[model samples]
Target: MMRNQTSSTSQTIRFTLIAFGLGVGLTTLVIGGADDATPIGTKWWPSEFGPADERGAANRITPKKVLEARDLIQDGKIYQLGRLYEHGMPIPGKRHFSLTIPGLPTGLPTGNNQMVSNDELVSGEIGQVGTQFDGLGHVGCRVNGEDIFYNGFKLSEFGNPYGLEKLGVENVGVFLTRGILLDVAAIRKADRLPNGYVIKPAELQACLDTADLEIRTGDMVLLRTGHGKLWMEDNDTYGEGEPGLGLAAARFLTDRKVALIGADTWAIEAVPHESDELSYPVHQWNLTRHGVYHLENLDLEELAADKVYEFAFMFSPLRLRGATGSPGNPIAVR
Candidate 1:
């Protein structure tokens, strides 16, 4: 049941069975209650990193992990897994991305050497746009009038109009770890998984088995749905719902202690989510509950085509003091 991305909230509750499964899993025991799908105000914080921690899953990138990843780079072939941030690129919802040169030559010749330059007046959610890396502060749960973020930090206490005091993207250091790409589209023998298609643990496991690969702790897992094929060609279709991981599948990765989850889809989790009671539950689960990061809107076509299931994945989020997220190109080395 692929729902339009612009559909109303009430129109998305088409999967009662999936929604029920979500409730049965990590969510609350009750299924239909307001707080059942993703419980609010419960004790899901103080993260494993401790009360004051903000660096989330990047904490898993130990020196040993770096060495492990480095060993996978035999050929030194690099795959850029980010899309171009230009106009007409599909942006989720009302988010905008625009880059313009203020003038033909923003700067005139200042010296005898003729140093003319064109500066860009870039606007629109720099951190949240393009190939975005969601930090800990990007999503939170509202509990009884209070917003709780990763480590159970209160939004009222740390959030500022200027920037957040905690869980800033800057707090997350570099990520260099073994990467595993599960080409679900190929395993399913489809060019692209249908919109609203929920990828479960079974599908992920099947892909791993087919590739003779197993996910390891601290690994960066990426999914290729083939939806990225629509990237610039069909912006309208791309902005619509997408196929991605479901809650149960996400739990599977988090249980393996994965450092991050990324996908070709704009939202790594399925749209018209498994539960109507929840919106982007996977985001809340990964970022807020488990301190795991998410890499969205990735470009994985080349990797999928090459059948590069294993590689060294590395990315460093911009050091934007208190930004909730960062946009940049994450690379995979083979």
Candidate 2:
């Protein structure tokens, strides 16, 4: 039988789970900055790791945490939690992803051995396409005519076309921690949520209550809105605004100390944003302010189908030095 998602079940979580603190240091930075897009006069510089640290929330994955996560793998079953990178996979404005080969047998036999090989040319936003991981440098805001990134580092100082000098995807180490899949779709008893749906804190809390789950500190929390069902079926419709966490939901999750947030949608939060003026406030709230990470365009259907709420989430972004993001297949083991 499925876990009963009723008010009475809330006590199940409260009784079984212990509150975990964000063990990582959180040293706030005082910088001069103000914008309608960001918190007024707020900054996350002089990070807990130090003023120059770049790993962000990844610091929460300690050796002890890894061992704990390892113990969760009892059945040795793994669920591939990433979308397939292809020609039409719901890309947003101006972003692109394509793979081509000049010819099936693009290579010719040059040596006497007569070895034939096939090669393909790949290009177009690999870091942010398909199943993508957003880095600290992926999003930032213009502050007083200066572009600032995570930890309040100036863009002029670290931004480079070739690669970032600081806050690059290379800085975020591997993530092998606890993962919780919040099946909001099942909670709503719907195949998929309507576009532009804003998930409120009460809904989130109630979903946790329904799932009999708790959001532990430093955990990688993924929200399955059932949007992945449209992944390859209707690319255009999927590209449109999606149902996801609202700005309020972002604040609530940040307070819970989740190290990362993933979703089947392109953007982790609601598109068109809460206020017309804000584009990606949640990105700024987590990636910049609270040092949290984001994994987008995931494939959580298997986990949801099996009702696997908890697992050992594992992902190691490609060490693509200075890239803003990384594309890879994250896995969840139960």
Candidate 3:
């Protein structure tokens, strides 16, 4: 975990609040005493969407929500909020992203015509690569001798070698709602927050106050930490760790009933983690506990630079049947 120190970026810092730093909330929650039979009280099963619900938070995108989102558009200006999917981008563990064209023409010329074609094959963890949408089926906690996913769905039902049969990316509909960018780096008076900086609830409130914007239910919130500036420029350092929401911050957004949360970093939660025992606790807290989805590896630089704090954000994940996630570019318009 990187300590809170003066970042090397040229952008001047504004807010002088001490960096909340890392390893904050994990100590109080777990006593290191729970067994497999012990119930996970984190909010699972019998969702508000009903027992058989598969779409999770996407159900919040009702017609009423659509109209509300459309109302935010004024100048018709759109900002692309997804990052480029290229070979050099940093990835977690053994995952990767790459593109290639097999041959010169890539395909044969048309008969009796001058038309030739080029086609490229994309190879990578399609659902997990750049600018990805994490579905309910994507995360779960093991308990009672089974791996439980969203709505207590077991791995035996949806987990498959080919694709997930349930809670797949196809189950999620679309997101069209008010997008709020909490530019934490800008608010903290830093071009980029140091790695492992755990964003606290106090910082979030200050950010909202700074923007004069309040987070409403079903809002898609984006946290801009400026970590993305290293994207494609330095893959190794980018993959090391990141500055993001702590457990407290996760609870803050989840309690507000936000449909989805995105960020400029790879994971929405702080890297190196607040707890070494819990694997992606925020992912579980939102996806399993409350069904709030997460969008990671986003590009919010343009939007941040323009100071577009609030706008209409929309993105449709490709309906890849039985896939855990979908790769696509999300857009924000003001």
Candidate 4:
């Protein structure tokens, strides 16, 4: 565990230096480009929010939008969209998670009351673990020898070893918006989508048609691929690959100007992706290009069972200064 953390730290430092230099050859490629000719800077920089905006699509959540979302709550039933963080939960890549009590009684019997207390010692990546929230800092595209994030925030200008000087998770404020769930599994007539199945725009349209719904601006969209069924019961399989959206489907949502996209799967985009050459391109398209956020490893079983397709979705990322992401239980109120 220490070794993994050490390696991650070193990689962070290395990447920081490389980004700061702006001329270093090393960079994480942004695959599945629109064309070989167009530069990423010209295509997606100076976001609609402007050059100085760090809030991204989240800026669309206005008082009117909040009232609009508030109107969605009819039943007053709340659904927890996040999964429990445990020792055996399915974690992606080399990330780690563990929780332990420091002692039988962390605090000795104090005062005359003979009171004792227990405290948990949590060790691992807190921000990017189970039920994670991806901030603007989470993903970036290296364009023309420079690492650029949302709103054209150049990593060379903001990258730091300790933490990002900009685009950190703390910059993302509260998200209270109309939330829609597209149960692609039910649309496909399957309990669980087969691994590596790519959800297309047609399927998304079909789901919306059935629900008599439309993706609106500043809405939070959740896709239930049913891959979450394997979460802890089959960790190995859950981590192997997933059934999720293709680039076109992602573009379909971004076209509607959604504030965020979430999924029952760990990664919202299909694993063993639509293109062998691009890895998690949907992530790049949404986070980097559109300044949208992502919520992952959601528990949508109750919502599916109750047939709650639209509701008031709300979540606030932890104010972890300079952190890349956050972990929290987002809720849906109907």
Candidate 5:
């Protein structure tokens, strides 16, 4: 047999226990924080790195601006700043010998054996030769400890499983804009910047001062170190030891929001540090982290000698979908 107590205090105690349990359930509803089920508006927040009042709004130059620049060039006041490719000049790092691929046919088909052609149609797999611009997608940092696209896209996501349809060389669009050439070598009083010599931030500023040119938004900055000539010497020591922009220099350029930064050298940054543990931090910082494009192996000797600092730049890269990079010939007219 059981005895039942129907007192007001007992009823109140029962109600209190139920209330406490309800309070705990409510607490969890409040403290769980916006889960996947939470409304999107409830989780919205302002971006931290967005444009500030002092800083101008983020803007991109339109095609009309480029066309306006071209119109300025038509005023008959611009000189072309690009190297003429020669047949026998020594290709960098390949010794004094000129470009000649063995087992490759040469000459056009003419006469009896019309089916065969000897001409190496200037096509096929030719290691990027001559002045070239490195596209933004050229090099990338490992994302999540894996070689992935900068946009978090997997490498495999490009193209069809076995065919070129998915990722073909036709994606990189044309680029035309105003170009500013910073003649660092001339300012340094040296014919060529030495290898391993890190260009300091102060020196870069000095070069800009000497040039007396202002860097505008959406401009491509080309830094001439006189190292291109050295590279053309075809000596291993040339590229093995050459002066290049330091990490600070790269930072300075990117801070200006320059669309692209180019140099007349193999790698825009100084030689790899002595410690094997240290690698190309500039590449990781600018190209990967900052979204800045790096243009390497530009031939700027002619332009520097001409003392042409401002120019209209034009370049079109092969639109290779999902390609790490496309070879480009960038021309500067001033």
Candidate 6:
């Protein structure tokens, strides 16, 4: 029995020594490979939040932080911002600025001298077209794997009900912070990034390096692939084509602790990888899982040429109660 115990003790000591040696070797390799001047936190991929054990999940930028970032941009200390709107730019859809109200009064007086004027205030439906904000309630995962509106809020919620009175647009209020634009197209030296191409982590890092910028806490990062231009030219191809960030890049951004993410494309992430696709995983990962906001269909051509890495961001969503999203007109000022 004494000899057996001694043998077990020897095995334990040997195992401990092996583990210690392996750990030391790994540490040396990592330290040696990293750039000496790289910030401690920058050397390795940073956690979305400060630490795992802290309250809340990863990549959560508080509202207060956003406000502080915004103030800096407004002071003209930062420059290079994107223009959200391009005049006469056609939005790819069946209805860009069309109005369709159900049950219009039939047999209205039709005469050459007929006049339709609003002499008194009456309320029904208003602005149903043009640029708009997409409120949080605009989209959601299926409760049982089926897409359904929350509380039966009609599609009209995309417009009307302006402000936070109904949908808490007030919660979003005015966002002031640093804005970073990643010109992915320039990195690849392509006039436009092809559709269906999922951007990888290495590619994203390369693009950032080319731009000579690093993401700071509470930054609004906008990724431009020249997809918006293609989208404007051909909606069908743009909607179904191969452009956008991949899951890995999304994870990296969330891990980097960005406050909001925007892209010049439709869906932020590459279409789901599965043949039996369910939900947009990026949306799930960022919005539902990580509490990160997404901005889509932004016009970023001008911003890319400006070579701006930072700016003041501002946006307000239409206040619609019981809605999934608000068609917001978001803008960035340098």
Lowest lDDT sum, 10 consecutive residues, model 6, at 1-10
Tens digit of per-residue lDDT, candidate 4, span 1-334? 0011111111233333432243312233222333431223234777898889998999989898899999999979999999999988987677899999987899989999999999999888888889999989988766656777887788999988788889998888999999999999999999999888989888999999999999999999999998989988998988888898876688788889999999998788877766444546677778988998999999999999999999999999999888889999999999
- What are the lDDT scores of the predictions, listed in order? 0.83, 0.76, 0.78, 0.81, 0.53, 0.51
Candidate with top TM-score is 1
Evaluated at residue 169, the lDDT of candidate 3 is 84
Model 3 pairs in collision: 13-189, 14-189
Better of 2 and 3 by lDDT: 3
lDDT of 3 by residue, 1-334 (tens): 1122222221111100111223333322322243312123423677888988898877877788788889989999999988878766767777778899888788877889868889998888888877888888887766645788888788987789888888988888889988899999998999999888889888898989999999988899999998999898887878788988877788889888899999988888887666453456677778887889999988999999999999999999999999888889999999
Model 3, stretches more than 4 Å misplaced? 1-43
Residue-level lDDT tens digits of model 2 in 1-334: 0011112111212211211111112222222232322232344576776888898888888887788789889899999998778887777667787788876678877788988788778888878778889999988766656778777788999989999999888888889998888888888899999877878778788778987988877889999898778889998778777888875687788888888999988888776455544456567678877789999988888899998888999999999999999999999999
Q: Mind giving the per-residue lDDT tens digits that candidate 1 earns over 53-149?
A: 8987889999999999999998999999999999888776677888899877999888989899999888988888779999999888775558788
The weakest ten consecutive residues by lDDT in model 1 span 1-10
lDDT of 6: 0.51
Tens-place lDDT digits, model 6, residues 1-334: 0000011111223323342342312121122233421211012212233322111221234676666655656445322233333333444343343324333433354679763332322222111222333334444333222332222222343334443223233345445566778888888898887766677667778877886878876677888888777645775666664477755577778778776788877667664332112235455445544445666777787767777656667655554454434465667676
Worst 10 residues of 3 by lDDT: 10-19
lDDT of 4 at 248: 66
Model 5 earns a TM-score of 0.66
Clashes (N, CA, C under 3 Å) per candidate: 0, 1, 2, 2, 19, 30
Taking every candidate in turn, the Cα RMSD to the unseen true structure, in Å, is 3.8, 9.6, 7.6, 7.4, 18.5, 15.2
Predicted candidate 6: what Cα RMSD to the true structure? Answer: 15.2
Task: Tell me the TM-score of each prediction against the true structure.
Answer: 0.90, 0.86, 0.88, 0.88, 0.66, 0.60
